[model samples]
Target: MKLRILITLSIMVLAFGIVSADFSLKWFYPEASNSTSSSDTFSIVNYDRMLYGATAGIYNLPDVNSVGSDPDDYLEIVLGSDELKNVEDTTDSSQGVWRCLDAEGNLEWAVGTGTDESRSSVAILDFYGSDGLPDIVSGTTSGWNVEAMDRFGNFLWTFPSPPHISGPYAWHSSPAVADIVPDISGLELAIGCNAGYDSTDNHWGMYCLQADPSDGMDDGITYSGWSDYPTAPGGTDGTDWDTIWFHPTDAPVISAPCLVDMNNDGILNVVFGTGWQGGIGGSLGQPGGKIICLNGEDGSLLWEYSTGGSYPAVSASLAAGDIDGDDDNEAVVGAYDGNMYFIDGDEDGDGTISGSEIAIYYHSGRVYSSPAIADVDGDGDYEVISGIGGGHLKCFHYEPSAATVTLEWYVDLGDSIISSAAIAGDPDDATPWLFFRGNVERTAFYSHTGDVLQIFISAMRGDNAYLYQVRGDGTVMDSVRIGEASYASPVVADIDGDCLLDLVITGANASYDSLFMIDFPGPDTIWCFGTDISIHGCETTEFHPQISNVYTEGCSLVYATVCVFDDDSNYVRGLDISNFGFLEDGTPIVPPNLEMINECPPETAKVDVVLLFDFSTSMDDEVGLMYTHVPEFISALRDVNYRIGIMVFNGCPTEIDGICNMVKTHF
Candidate 1:
């Protein structure tokens, strides 16, 4: 449901490029372009045919999207009669709810509440595994609780169970789920705390709780020994509820901690940062922000790095990848001081980063941008893309040998930049760029098929706010104005599941409080998802759901299939011959197969043995990664033989099957 290594190509304005709403009016809910105000922007995920937006205030996400301001934050929104517990905010005059919308600007469901307010991020996974459905996991600004709820807006469980365990510690950090404790039964949920909006002295930390408590403890809290760091009694009535561990921090961790298994070990390491509340100790207020790595098993510190500056706070998040093909990930991040640091993620086998283990590159302006690793020059190696203060967007080529960075190019947009850059593939490029193509085991899509697309989001102060999509030469490919100002950068994803990607974003000023999606207008390429089932006989009389392929194993028994989708485009299952009536040649043959195929194709197209396509882990995965690359894979198959055959998923190459922690292949 999340990307470990964000793969991108090309270069651009601020972060990543997208097709703006100006070119095409795909959609904006409430129907009006300026119906609501999306105050501060947060993050969002379009999965299961829906979009779950978190805390979007327009800062990477939190721009001025209008999240509530309360000790117990609450937000209210209206979406197609499906009220997700809307709770109004006294501080906010606008009403824009965290929503789950389709590509056509149609809202499936919308939820807003007190415990649900100010959710800066969300994690989509089968938290409890109950009903075998993916649930939504998010943390509220002051909720201080890792919340798990179904897509229908049903409240499932809250870690530490009711009654204010730590007195509303504020969970600005999005909950991360992983099987950290193998012996603990279910999965583990790791989350961090923010400044708590506390005026003066207040401590911030992180939590490691059970991903699903139904399997073991019913209280939704358990941390083996709760050892390593420190554990405070969270049970209000003394019922004895405890968590895995609590790693304390002097300042707020407004940034979401990343959970990565850097070494591919079964265990994961939590990497995160913190910001100074005004400075803790020392005369000039020591740089409060720092990068901290925690041992996922017991909540211990793996390694830590401090950023040097007047008030160097890492408001932006950190990214990890193997820059030199060393198989070890290097941590990349930026600070408010306009500098980006590169840390050797214990690559030297010393388990600690020191002296030569770290490298620094300055953007020369305050940086509020998170780094995106991609290869823009197609030079084979990856480059770092980020935005800094003074309205500059910079790219640096990463040299893993010396752990140093050299500026490849820099552009001053004449405005401040707090937005992070995003990477994607332009529909026109031959190979959609992927991050670390050398690490074949990690990528989800087929490399060398689409070119990399880089886009930048500027932090403009006034109506000068604009979305820029640039070519590799720092020239504008396409530029459009999106309202007055948008602090948060929008994302380019397939909102309608059209098999094509779309751009979804929120605006500022008059266009705040609204979440809109615009189609990425370009080549309407079709990616062959296995969803296009084949039907024998190719007849027109019988019911046919999108027929993608038609062939016979032996030309005997007829086989048919269909890709059934509800209004949301989610796959529809559980129906057999009874779901639809079957008829053949006017006499109502009542074929049980339900799918009609053309009379045994006069001839068959030859298919050559191409490599198996792996639909493994990718940035977007409501369906398989192969969904986007299927077109190329099918084209390759057809070019060789003329028709496609049963695909052999060798895992691109392999998406890495966790069943054996190895690559998997099947007919």
Candidate 2:
């Protein structure tokens, strides 16, 4: 996951910086998966994964809203299968209500409203109402419904709902928000809905709706409008929209739309795929689906490429980056056809893609995970990494000079992989590692560059789990048994302020659902809390609990931030001082501080050096003697920002390059 810095809450003390030590359990939104992230801020939003329709919750960061004030409070937007339910303020049970759009695109009472078989698709936007806070937009899979609400979960407006389709789960695609219109101030919501398989209207494709409809506090959804696929000529919704590009076989877009400036022309384009044929509960065995690129501004088709196989080419979301450092970015994605492709955005600089613009590498297994880009090998270029269903972690190298894309290395675990690889640690350091779950048996770990064989497999057998640490040279460092099975990717970070990256994994088996923090260097085990199914860590700063440098005149305070998480109850507790008093290697922090007592210099000090040289007699003896000590003198002053000035003189005046150096000048 990409770390986005969005918090500005600073706790100030007397020259003492703030440091965040341990995390507390903030709150929980039931039935929500970490799969969905909030665009409104650096917070988490969850959708219902179960077939039973429920409400979507938006848990804002601490101190973001003044309404509820408590961190545990959240906004609940009710969703149902058969009817549109009312939007409720679950934060304080305040019964606050707002207006929303019904399935027919008309303003109606949103409180206690229910709809026919709904699927929660939540996204954040800041363009809806007069309030500066972010607004929420959600869509339904069965009712083809889309609604907008304020940050407080107050209903704002809804777009005209499309015809709900009942068929395989492949027809449901989550809605994505983007500012597609050049002149629009806010963003536009784009979603793909299936028009039902057994119905006469096969209207299944991407739909675009103006996100912000608030003209003022009194006026809501000034113009409720939407445009569907297959271009409805002279429809009631509006005629100003561009042509609606439908899927080739009426397949719904299951992958999230990747909005990027693929052509490097500063204009954003939408890249998505059509798949989910055959069936929903299991493998459809569908193929030959296409990944299409369309102009964001007018929804015109920019390019379309087929998967070429009989199975769905794209069931995974597309990732875009300039893997070869070309001005144009290449769209990297995986298809059910067992091939990972890198499609050139602008091959001939014509702002369009043809069939020849794609580069493919067969992974030998279906790829359901998204691709990631990183300079894993310490090279100046990026490498593509993805997890395949056949339990293979595939890494592809991009040689920018030779323009070749080939498989660098792949590790095959003996099980299936449904989760994506979490690439973490300092990329500047050559030892970054990746962690991912490999189904029923173990979670595999690998070196970042793909050259080493250090395999740390966290294996789980029923209620018993074992954590193994193997070195690159095939040496098993340690194998400790942990209690539960975990399906989520482990997060690697310097969690305990020990300056060593630790692995934080969440247990996912039936008996256990707690988080485990494993120390890196010694593999020291630290068990804090349990029973929470999910957790997320943020880089935060707090004032150091102890260890202050006291100068004669003042004290120099140091503050450092690391990764921390709250317990399941939303309670944040401070760890004992002993837990953070030692380094990862068990080195005492006190000893290092005592040895470096005089390391800090005065804050307001400056240094200047003057060099006197004579060139009148070409005195080689004196010059050589000065030269011998020059290195030592410069080294002594290197610790400080010092300036060295030289004074040169020969006969009457030294003239060089049409200028006379008669006085000291700093260089």
Q: How far is candidate 1 from the true structure (C-alpha RMSD, Å)?
A: 18.2
Instruction: Report, for every candidate in turn, its global Cα lDDT versus the true structure.
Output: 0.45, 0.41
TM-score of each: 0.59, 0.51
Name the 10 consecutive residues with the lowest summed lDDT in model 1: 521-530
Number of clashes recorded per candidate: 67, 41
lDDT of 1: 0.45
> What TM-score should be assigned to candidate 1?
0.59
Candidate 1 segments exceeding 4 Å error: 1-23, 30-97, 160-169, 195-203, 216-242, 263-266, 276-287, 348-352, 426-450, 456-458, 510-667
- For candidate 2, write residues 436-518 as lDDT tens digits: 22110011222234222223334344454444443323234444444343232333323222233334333222211123232
